[model samples]
Target chain A: MVDVTAPPLSPTDRSTVRRHRDRQRADRAELHAVLDEALVAHVGRVVDGEPVVLPTLHARVGETLYLHGSSGAASLRGDEPVCVTVTIIDGLVYARRWFTQSANYRSAVVRGHARRVTDRDEALAAMRALVRQVAPGQEDHADPPSRKEMAATSIVALDLTEASVKARTGPPGDGDAVAAGDDRWAGVVGLATRVTGVTTCPALPEGTPVPAHVPTG
Target chain B: MVDVTAPPLSPTDRSTVRRHRDRQRADRAELHAVLDEALVAHVGRVVDGEPVVLPTLHARVGETLYLHGSSGAASLRGDEPVCVTVTIIDGLVYARRWFTQSANYRSAVVRGHARRVTDRDEALAAMRALVRQVAPGQEDHADPPSRKEMAATSIVALDLTEASVKARTGPPGDGDAVAAGDDRWAGVVGLATRVTGVTTCPALPEGTPVPAHVPTG
Candidate 1:
């Protein structure tokens, strides 16, 4: 519903960080990058005057983020304000001082009132996009959602008009005193989500090789 | 301050899931496992009447979750209600039908009003636990937080009373129709947080070997 096309990264009143403003990435491209790399997002919504955060799969189609869950899901049902966050932890920063220790990560937060997709055509397209984002090339291979399946699922579309992206990369920025002292090691241990192996279903005939598109390390 | 020691997983008014109740893990040990494996938590707080979620390093100390941030961080400053969620994406489930696709993940959510830890000793211990959780042996090598550093950091503790843990592992549970048709691969691609390498600080002396505890694939 919100038209945010190539808009400059302008922080809204809520998006501004009171601390660590240096780490805030105001570039719109940065927000897109974080959303693209993430397969799941933690969505926060107010339930009964209390905040509830739930993890769910998400996909970005242009300026809108589509989050799908069972139609019966209480959190995704109503048209309420929601905050979706995607975080990619890149590494752990080991600092010389305990207070300075931190994680190297790229995170994006989008705040908007979710609009449940009701148009059948739009819902199908959003579902396809979600499939493509999670497992590339599978949309064409897998059967499309049936009428019953479509009716049973709820897809909420959130516009990226108001969003914030913050990232901290590279080595730990030790303080002057810790940098001067050379008693211990100080660096980053790179962390990544690696596809260790592909597992075929037991129902599948034996020797069915994993498709090339399936990610495998 | 909530004493929820190994109580039965009674669904709080806000913690009940209307969809996919089978995925909910009721055991307290399951909650602890998810918290232990997670390095970061997406913390949600109501800021200016809008839900805001931020990613931060977190450590578990028995029944409490300690989240530290810059004392100046507006989101961490107040004793407002907060919801902290830890999610671990274990794999990507490839189902035969697009509608059945889901991620294999373990997620835990804790909802409570954050209590700012002003006690110097408790704050110090929390900081040390945080350091040890992220980079195990590094805590022994690194200097403790100085008085100024301690004063600059803010630690918020959330009790584990009203919490929910949900996990979905193993293969994709395709419907009867989808399972009967075996044209495409149907299983989960195991994903893991792999330590690709360690980037040591240039400040270190020449030829300083990477520490053994520093994770390396």
Candidate 2:
């Protein structure tokens, strides 16, 4: 989780929560929570006159969001306007009406210019944070990036200053229909990401055994 | 699944797959599979001179991808360039080196002009498909959209004509390290989305009985 002591999300013009404004979360901790939990972030950028969006591995390092990809990924360009968005789906809402059918999800949209990480120390720290963000203990277990590897990598940082956190939870909005003598079923079906299993490298001895840090099914 | 008979994905200049080009999938079924399994899509559009991306409920009907949201949502514009991207993370690759650590994910990036659905019949079908896309059987059990409800909703359709699918699978790339005198553990930690539970509406009578179509954990 990000530092809870940080201030609330900035009330910038672009920070206005879209869709159900009532569901907007004002706490900065809430913004960190959303960014911390989700794994893949969709990075959007304008290329020439067309819009390009791609999913990239992302992690939050304090107040900055780091997005990772190969050096060739066009969306990682420096000083370009970008939108990074992440969504964690909690469940499926089965409402009485098709129009009311929706998802229970916590999402964060961060809008800002991408600042390419050129400082070697900052880039290395961001890379470590990104790996730990996905698999917590692996940062210590895995080898740090070699000097040659770091030279070929590309990472861009976005300030978490201008962002919006919007979420939907609880029962369906049309639960009133059930209380109003309508027998139709309506509620939430919960969903979550679970570890299915673990497979050791085929090149290793068959009895190598899974590590304590790696999660298993 | 989309029709297996559908032609392969078009290879336009914009459709050229980005990042790890070797991971680009050529089959149209691959694109449909990625779109069908992922629950949320990041929709990006150029707002003013900047980019805005939001997570929206998206579904595929034949060659068109329909994104659903309230009419006030700005991304659901008519004939405007938009980018829709979906990602399904399969696992985490625990590689020997931080630079080699990667995610096993299937992602599809669709880019084109948004064609807002104005026809009532088209909108209704798109709505039905979108609901059913999330909860497979909910479309039949839930109430069909009312005339007034449909009027308040907005859906924009983008052709599947210009899109690219990229996927990474199998073991970690650094498996060779295991045979090269390095005993470090390295492989994949598999992941999947699962149903946790089903909660019936509280307003309904106690023991209301979840419908057979609803999944229970």
Candidate 3:
């Protein structure tokens, strides 16, 4: 339905998709939705002339994206050119042929220099957003970070100025094969991220009531 | 329980995890397990010196991992250095403090020069593997790709030679806070990839008997 075609939004050439331009969504809201729906992001940066990609938890606050990592993590330090991408696998498309078989997915790719959040207030807000991003009401239930804990955590913020979203939806791409009288079965097997269960900590008392804020199966 | 800390399998200096050594799993099996369980992977490569990461479909065959893309996708062309990373979020950990809150996840990172699959047999095998990876029984159900279809597809093989896996499980990291008499509730909200539904192609007549192989909600 993204007609840049009507939702036109990407500013940079590199952020735009060359192939399957039809799947590209330039809407800023579409960009934010892709980042917010997923729990993890694959962060990449050139390390010694080679690209290194690592998966980490991410949170989005308006145009800013914050990635969570350890203070000792080398990739998270310093302002460096980076790419952060998140994908939500919607379904597996079983088409008439292997070439046409595909997955229905929504993915967002953000490229920019990542800067460590140095200001205490900004860092505090980002930290709260990170916790809330993963488990909504749990942010209020969890204690605020202590001074020592903050020292051990690293929060790097990357602006979402240059970003693009690509998504493929609906049935198999080769419906014409059926029109050609191919009897082969074709359909989509949907996939989703689900909460399987809530397991309490062993150290906590056995009857420790499961918090209402936590997602349960 | 990956004890190199016992499974010690990383051969290169960069593949080793400097932080959270306890979470790094060196077993080859662990790396394979992480790749097989996830439906999508984030592929990263250096483009004009800045790193670029995009999500795509992938299938693993023994020591080789195959990434599928359109023939026109520039990033998938030529032999280039890449980092393929996949993350399976096991659960959301709600800890006593924001600092201690974390995700229970298993992730794998593989780095190598991806070479195009030119040989027809290898390409065909990789294509079948790719289909089966997403939906097991569909490989047999779907028709094999024709010559023109093969020309429009690209399969790149990257060796699993340089790779590492990291996983975190069990209760929250801060059980001592409970011992300190903090009334805050803390536990794990498990997450999993699930099949939500099956939708047949719209072009095909409705009430077409659903196949047995596709995963369903």
Q: What is the interface RMSD of candidate 1, in Å?
A: 1.8
Residue A129 of model 1: what lDDT? 89
lDDT of 1 by residue, A17-77 (tens): 5667888887888999899999889998876666778888889988999998556646676
Give the CAPRI class of candidate 1: medium
Task: Find the 10 residues in a row with the least total lDDT in model 2 chain B.
Answer: B69-78
DockQ of each: 0.67, 0.81, 0.79
Per-residue alpha-carbon lDDT of model 1 for B1-217, expressed as tens digits?
A: 6445677554586776566789888788899999988988999887667677878889999888999755664667648788999999998888888987878999999999889898899898888889988899888878898888887788889988888888888777873543555656777889989998888876777567777777767
Task: Give each model's whole-structure lDDT.
Answer: 0.83, 0.87, 0.86
True contacts kept of each: 0.78, 0.90, 0.93
Q: Provide chain B TM-scores across all predictions.
A: 0.93, 0.94, 0.94
Q: Against the hidden reference, what TM-scores do the models get?
A: 0.94, 0.96, 0.95
Candidate 2 C-alpha lDDT tens digits along B32-126: 99999989999988988788888998999988999984566454666799899999999999988898899999999998889889999999999
Give me candidate 3's TM-score against the actual structure: 0.95
Q: TM-score: which is higher, 1 or 3?
A: 3
Error of 2 at B151 (Å): 0.4
Query: Compared with the true structure, what per-residue lDDT tens digits does model 3 show for residues A52-154?
Result: 9988889998789999856665557748999999999988898988888899999999899999888888888999999999999877888888888787778
* DockQ, 0 to 1 scale, candidate 1: 0.67
lDDT of 2: 0.87
